[model samples]
Target chain A: MASNTSDLRSPLARARGLGSAKDGTEHWWGQRLSAMALVPLTIWFVFGVIRHLGADYTAFHAWMKSPFSAVMMILTAVVTFHHAHAGLQVVIEDYVHVEWQKLALLIAVKFLSFALAAACVLAVAKIFIGA
Target chain B: MANGSGRPLSPHLQVYKLPLTAILSITHRITGVGLAVGTLLLTWWLVAAAVSPEAFARAQGFIGSGFGLLLMFGWSAALYYHLCNGIRHLVWDAGKSFELSDADRNNRIVLGAAAALTVLTWIVGLAVW
Candidate 1:
């Protein structure tokens, strides 16, 4: 009963999230998980590209129509870009000196990454679903 | 943590001779950035394929151009390096290969693997089509 009254930590301190300034471990682990997933997917992708070298749109369209390849492509796009954004944020935080410039770049990178991912997903869907 | 004392702001890169581990660590970040850029090109190719054969051809033509091919080659090199170094990093994450000797050997292996993989992939690409 006395321990409750004697506790010194403020509510703000008690409620503080985690890791360097309340958040980071999760982001760190996110990069690791995504990287692990990408290892096989990237290898598969490289081989797939090699197999399709010089093949025209018709060939690609045909190959991507398979639910398996289409799904893998989508997953790769999402995880890779998310991982890229996370890594790039740290790079900018480390290097970019000007506050506005860093903020602008961080925003731009996220926008481009997410936009590309969305477009890739839609494209894969269009081909996979024949829509 | 800050007083107006004449203190070093940060460690200068030029002062110290970087070891292979440090060099590869920096390369990891550089390739990470390069891959982010390379994804845009991949995205374009994918969208064009999704659009029409003509559009895809146009995309292919650009990518097949000499300059475009060079860029793609560089991108591929970055990709291979990043992926290889990434695996090395994951191994470190498992709390292995932390010794300086291990760092030296493993980092060199990562570089060699990246180079070999890049060249091999291109060769396979050329032979296939």
Candidate 2:
């Protein structure tokens, strides 16, 4: 390996960490934001599930139509997927070593999570609009 | 440590008799990964419900089946545990819960509560269904 004598970058910097985004803690804040949102949204979802237990298609459709439920569902899907993407990106960065592979996987995770969330939101919106 | 101190906490991992807290920490990460993957079921069900009566029924049949129930049992347990531990993490993020004994106690509590919640949810779920 070729060494650069002119390379003034501190060894401490190399040993201690990887590249910093330098833009601030956007990722961390975004994650916490989503988490706080989920606390209430998740609770609502579970309770709603219990309430609608043994419900058939019409019941579910009706449940989905309520403006309160429809809006909450959209928020839940968007925030959950945003949160999941951020968390998974961190995990992949921490574990995956190969540079290209890591890049590929991160992009794929971003794409997949967003796509799925969009689909879910669209489904919820359809029910809302139909009613 | 210091740069020359042979890496911070290297001896601690080796020296600790049993790192129960450490184990729980890793399990938190694993369960997070599992839940992320398992969320495909949620997506499928929502899409099916939006698509048509037939599609929704097909989704229902799969989830209500024995194999699907088993998967749900595992995923639901993972969900509860992850949620419990995740709240613990958020607490720690607020600069609390640092005492070693308290940390251990809370870890146990998180695990216990998750198990109880999972069982209770399923019991009610099955009973209702």
Native contacts kept, each candidate:
0.85, 0.45
Candidate 1's DockQ: 0.74
Q: Candidate 1 lDDT, tens digit per residue, B6-38?
A: 775565578877777888899899889889888
**Candidate 1 runs further than 4 Å off:** A1-20, B1-11
Off by over 4 Å in 2: A1-20, B1-18
TM-score of chain B of 2: 0.86
Candidate with maximal DockQ = 1
How does model 2 score on DockQ? 0.48
Give the clashing pairs for model 2. none
TM-score of the second chain, each candidate in turn, equals 0.88, 0.86
What are the DockQ scores of the candidates, in order? Answer: 0.74, 0.48
By TM-score, the best candidate is 1
TM-score (chain A only) of candidate 2: 0.81
* Candidate 2 structure quality by residue, lDDT tens digits, B1-129: 656777666546566676778888888889888878976888998888898888888887887889988888898888788788888988988999999988989988998999999989988888888
